[model samples]
Target chain A: MFVHGLATNPGWDWPTFFQFFATRTIFSALWVTVQLTVYGTVLGFVLGAVLASMRLSSSPFLQVVAWGYIWAFRSIPLIVQLLFWFNIAYLYKELSIGVPFGPEFVHFSTNNLFGPLGAAVLGLALHQAAYAAEIIRGGIISVDAGQLEAAAALGIPRIRQFFRIVLPQAMRSILPNGANEVISLFKGTSIVSVMAIPELFYQVQVIYGRNSRVVPLLMVATVWYIVLTTLLSIVQYYVERRFARGTAR
Target chain B: MIDVKGVHKSFGDLEVLKGIDLDVPAGAVTVILGPSGSGKSTLLRSINHLEKVDRGLVRIDGELIGYKRRGNKLHELREREILRQRSQVGFVFQTFNLFGHLTVLQNVVEAPVSAQGRKRSEVEPYARELLERVGVGDKADVYPRQLSGGQQQRVAIARALALKPKVLLFDEPTSALDPELVGEVLDVIKELARDGATMVVVTHEIGFAREIADTVVFIDGGRIVESGPPREVLDNPVHERTRAFISKVL
Candidate 1:
């Protein structure tokens, strides 16, 4: 750490330039990266499952809607979507969290919700859901009709069968694909820097702009992302193994 | 406990089952033997509405099948009403369709717990007992993929029995098994017959029909050609088609 600072600026004391941020901004953004991934992944998975079911639904209207969504989102790159969502024009009205019939509980608008951190997470999540929908849809179809009949024969209702019998088998088909989505999501978070998310990429840009240490600061951001995605890959490996049980090795 | 009347079914231009009307008694084993494309399997599937019949009716325990909840012979019976009733008529396949994800114990207990709404804790012991009866008790914790062809078929039998069905249907149950594995499945069926369970079997196994069936039904070209006590039917057949089929297999 000391040598890196000195090498970047040798004329004066380097720690003065480094101490201001070493103790704060980069470290703070590290926390933001974690939060972005956690919140983004959760939101994305919930939305994606709904979208996938919509695509799988027998009704042509729903299938067409789902198809339209996937085509629009997946075709235009993730980086572009992240930027668009962060800007004012693209956002819908802010979220209003309230009881449906009773009373207005709370409302938060677009400006407030798209804070540096929120924008990053939201961008990654919405984009990720489209791909996840396709992954989940494929998994659901792979399950045989006979198995559903057997479940039906047991008098197990259709709704319960989706969660219980169908989902477990589908997990085997979906998890590997889902792992790719997660990794893609992690990469997608990089786009958040343009939204002023103050994530690793943003912090690196800030550091490089001030110090003219472009290569080193950019390298720092690159290392962090590599490490994080590598860790996610490890997690994915184990999840795939658990779901793939009893299938051919 | 089961009746079929004038059941006709077709697949596109190919007419599979042409006017199949057959009756099976309470607690009796009825074996259906026929050539390929003769529609024996189609006729059996039609009874449960698994394969829809263009025209005809199936009655199990006096309730008519293929009718709407309000439209037909039945005053009421939900789609699930039909499902629960159909659960009472278990169908075993040539390829054991035991759910690959679940353990043998879970497979055996799934219907009882989910369909019958029996407590899993209450049904667990019964499931184990059925597994043991089928000689797959040791494999109860194993998944279907982990078991042999014989073991999987037995687990399937155990799965069917988990429902404690009124009439068990076998669609060439042993036909998919290897030569060595076929005997184990047959032995399980023999035990089921002795226990007085009603069965409708589609099989090529002449000896099993002779040994265990109360009645042997020979269907040729979607029609019942000869049916009687197994010894009588297998020994001396009346129809040329039945005679020809028997001669070919022998």
Candidate 2:
């Protein structure tokens, strides 16, 4: 009865859903979502790797700095962080590149430089970095100390040891958790809708608001998210297999 | 070719080695035997600079290990330099520390290629030869986890030999192996000894030491209680502590 009602009901608007699904506006909005996810993941993981190394370093100052960053970012909600970045112009008039406490070399007006999209990406990356840092550190520490000792005893260069010996082993532990964070971030990109960036979720809201076809428009966005997330999961599977080279039974 | 002079090491308040002085001539097999917590491993590790000495010097072929001698002071070598020095001194642990991510052949080839800067093409054939020598040639493409404990230990030995190290240090290489698997690893080490490799081994195997060791040094309470030819130290221990320890192990 539910399937028959949905198929027959005029409110289902299957024709309108099909018409708008392949439209240029919705496709462009999806492109925006893709950009956000890609930029957020790449930048977040890069910063996270640096933070993880800092946390693992012998220097107390680096450890404290990494701890403070993770603490502060994690404490703030992602939406609140995004809102703050969106209104950063109110907090600071200009961002600059210069020596500390010295004359500015170049400056960019905050309002002009960080538009809605830039603010969303920046907010997502910074928020994602905190979680990524912990994941990476957990992976590194999960590797046995004996592996490193063996590498060092063999006189492998320190850099080579980290890349060849430590990283491969760490990835075996890191992949599942890292993939979780990425999938979360991909879905989390929808939160940028509040900043008025026309990503997939915001675009769907816009179409339903105009045409009053809420359920069908919502279904379109849901299907796209499922398809993309499935692709990401497939990629994660292959990457995990690559790192799990030796330990497989 | 290995010289350890007045080496003293402590971990916090526990002094592991108390001014150890020993010398192993070129091409000699020196076996260190001691009860647990007596610092036999510490002394063996000190020879390779795995455990840095709080006081004293270790030299392999007259080059100070882990330090460069300056004007009356010892400056610790940078990591790169220390690594280059370490490439000359191979160490095998009680736990067969094979690179688990790498295949048996890759584990053997990694150090010689990456650490010593040998060509992979050249190292590959030589690595297979070393694997064959160690009796793991058939398992070359397999990971360390796929092999038995005895096979893994043999691959580790092959890895150490790939570097053509001046001295090889074994810290209870067979201690972690099953009783049934111990002989295979021991036979390999005995062969290395017969080939006149300069090796310092720390083991509880009294029979193996007597058969393979040129010098047997028995340590007790962070000091060498007795050391001489294998028969003298094993059969006719001069010190009462050595006699007691030997009797227990025998």
Candidate 3:
């Protein structure tokens, strides 16, 4: 360990690395990164599933609305969306839940309604949802039409049929692509630094700005991302295996 | 008991069934034989509302299959109601569309326990009994992919029987199986016929139809060309179209 430390000690950058690790700030920042990823992915998945269902619905209005959501979100850059949501106070001074174009039952200042963390999660999740929706839609569509026909002929309720038969099979196709989105989202969390959220990357930037150990502190953030993504990849493998049960090779 | 009247079905520009009419009484086996693309399958699918008729009605046990008759209008049943109606009429497909992710037993017990709202414990034994009767009892715990074509088809039969429907429809059940495995599935159908289950079968197998059919209906160009007792239709077809089709197959 002494020899390795000696070999790696370039301009005493190791001290900054050690200092960053020893402080509670780095760990808290790491927590923020995890929170954003987990919540973003989960919320994104729910919205994506709903959007995919809408896209597949018989109603033309729903199909168009779903299509517009996906097209708009996916077409806009993630950074632009983050900025737009973070500065949403400019567009609407107050957020309210009440009748449209009528009296407001309740209201709150937009700036107070959403903080930086909320804005980051909202931007990341909504953006991820657009891509996730298509992935899920493709998966649902890829299932054999015969399966639906069979389920219908068997008299299984439509909702039950989708959950029991269709979704299970669809998972076989959805998992691989869904895993891609999750891993991408994990790394994508780094972009939240723009909002001054003080997540891992942002914290690293703050530490290096004070200490001037730029490259090494950046490496610290890089290593953490690689480690987290590697662990996530391992999880993806097992999840795919579980969903692939009873399916033909 | 199933009744089909003036059932017309068209796809795009091609009319598949041009006003078909037939009646299948309780405990009778009606075997429909026809050449490919002759709309025999379409006719079979219409009975259970899998294929809606453009102009006509299908009645099962004195109830309209997929519509609620109100006064002078027939409103299409909602999905939930249609599902409830379908649970009482079992169907077996040619390709054996068993749920691949489910085990044989799960496939059989699914419709009964979920759609029919029966308890799992209550349905399990009968599901196993159906599997045993279909000759796939030992394979119930296995996935559909792990089973042979014949085994999968038998599992499908068991699945349909689990619903305890008043009538069962088979659409070329053996056509998708290998020749060597065909008899296994045919044997199960033969046993069902002997038990006097009401069945409507659309198939190309002349021999199997001859052995089990109470009435053999021949279809050509989306119309029933000839229909009668097995011997009369199979051995001595009067219509030239039926004769030509039988001649080609035999």
Candidate 4:
């Protein structure tokens, strides 16, 4: 009972873990987590928007390419993809750009191309883009067919029709799901700990490994995740309310 | 003026408009009367290239609807060019397809400001005047869903008129309204007719057709059975199909 008590005791574990949390290094780790989530989700959204538009485009070749990308990324696990990207230096020694079947115009060694942090962001953003594309496509499709017809009949140009007529309405459908994606992506950033990227979760793992106190460090990470998700939910609520105007109650 | 010559359209194996020909003279109210699934709407939609015809031509004032005539081969115009042509042809849909997110005034001003690149300040006064003329002046800032079916249709008319289009196309404008709400919409159309607006209306409203149409065309099975002045075609039809249809509707 005495040994069990020492292992499980909150007072001992929490105080020791709190000392690590108070260190300036932990704050830097937290910043890394914030940066990864922000850059990852923003880049994901831009790529997702393009993929969704491509999937819905009239051109068959574009449709096939978008479909293939979404299928491949969505089918693979994010953790495996992260590891693959982290170890990509082995898969391809270098990346280069040039005219097709012509001399290389620019070259970058794979080892110099992406660090652990870059690999983590690339993995998460690519994975997030697959899901985001589907979400955005669903939102765009949810707008009534008649709305498109009405815009076409009114002689509004395709670009203006999308921006002024379609996208605003699509956003009404998109915001709720998009907010969920953002929150989920924030939590999913913890997966980067596998690559030793020194984000919040990675920092917690390091602290626990040093002190041999795992349970309390896990609790700290959980508390931070809950706080982040709650903040995201609040933002989602306000955005939804803004777009909900003019729609019937 | 609108001209549809040898227009043919099909969806899968089902032909919707079969070698159809129609001519709507300038400043004339040509009402197309038909039963459901008789291809009246298809013919109307082809005028502005909403639904591209498989064969033949749709020309507005001798200009091709959605194609550029380079010799004899009809090349489809780019989407941008098609959009520019569509602005001159106002279409009021059966369901009153107003931009639901927009206020009534926004719906009216969208085409002139966005499509024609007209200044909002210059377009706004005319937009307001059109709304007032159509009896929806006070409801400018209100969204579409808040308005009754009749009020919404009136706003749709005002929106169409905002473009000051070369021709107005109405595809069963009053059919989607409540029975009690139908008269307000027909009244707006009657007003447009009185002002010598060129229009092609597709409707089941027999009484309104008799009152407003200069020419009445009865269609069945994707073919125009009879067409003449409303009094002659509506009251004294020459074809058996027209007589049968007029009997059932009236």
Quote each prediction's TM-score. Answer: 0.87, 0.97, 0.97, 0.96
Would candidate 4 be rated incorrect, acceptable, medium or high by CAPRI criteria? medium
- lDDT by residue (B162-206, candidate 1, tens digit) is 887888999999888899999999999999999899889999999
TM-score value, chain A, candidate 2:
0.95
Candidate 4: deviation at residue B228, Å?
0.5
Ranking by DockQ: 3, 2, 4, 1
List, residue by residue over A122-232, the lDDT tens digit for candidate 4: 999999999899999999999999899999999998999998898889999899889889888898999899998999999998888887788778777777788878888
Output DockQ, candidate 2.
0.82
Which prediction has more favorable DockQ, 2 or 4?
A: 2
Supply DockQ values for each candidate.
0.46, 0.82, 0.82, 0.80
Candidate 2 per-residue lDDT over residues B1-250, each given as its tens digit: 9988999999999999998889999999999999999999999887777778899999999999999889999999898998899999989999988999999988999999999999999999999999999898999999999999999999999999999999999999999999999999999999999999999999999999999999999998898888999989999988989989988998
Order the candidates by lDDT, highest first. Answer: 2, 3, 4, 1
Top DockQ model: 3
> Which residue ranges in model 2 land beyond 4 Å of their true spot?
A1-13
Name the better of 1 and 4 by TM-score.
4
Please list the residue runs of candidate 3 whose C-alpha ends up more than 4 Å from where it truly belongs after superposition. Answer: A1-12
What tens-digit string does per-residue lDDT give for candidate 3 at B1-250?
8999999999999999998999999999999999999999999999999998888999999999899889999899998888899999999999999999998999999999889999999999999999999998899898999999999999999999999999999999999999999999999999999999999999889999999999999988888898999999999989988888899999
Best by lDDT: 2
lDDT (Cα atoms) of all candidates against the true structure? 0.81, 0.93, 0.92, 0.91
Residue pairs in clash, model 2: none
DockQ of 3: 0.82
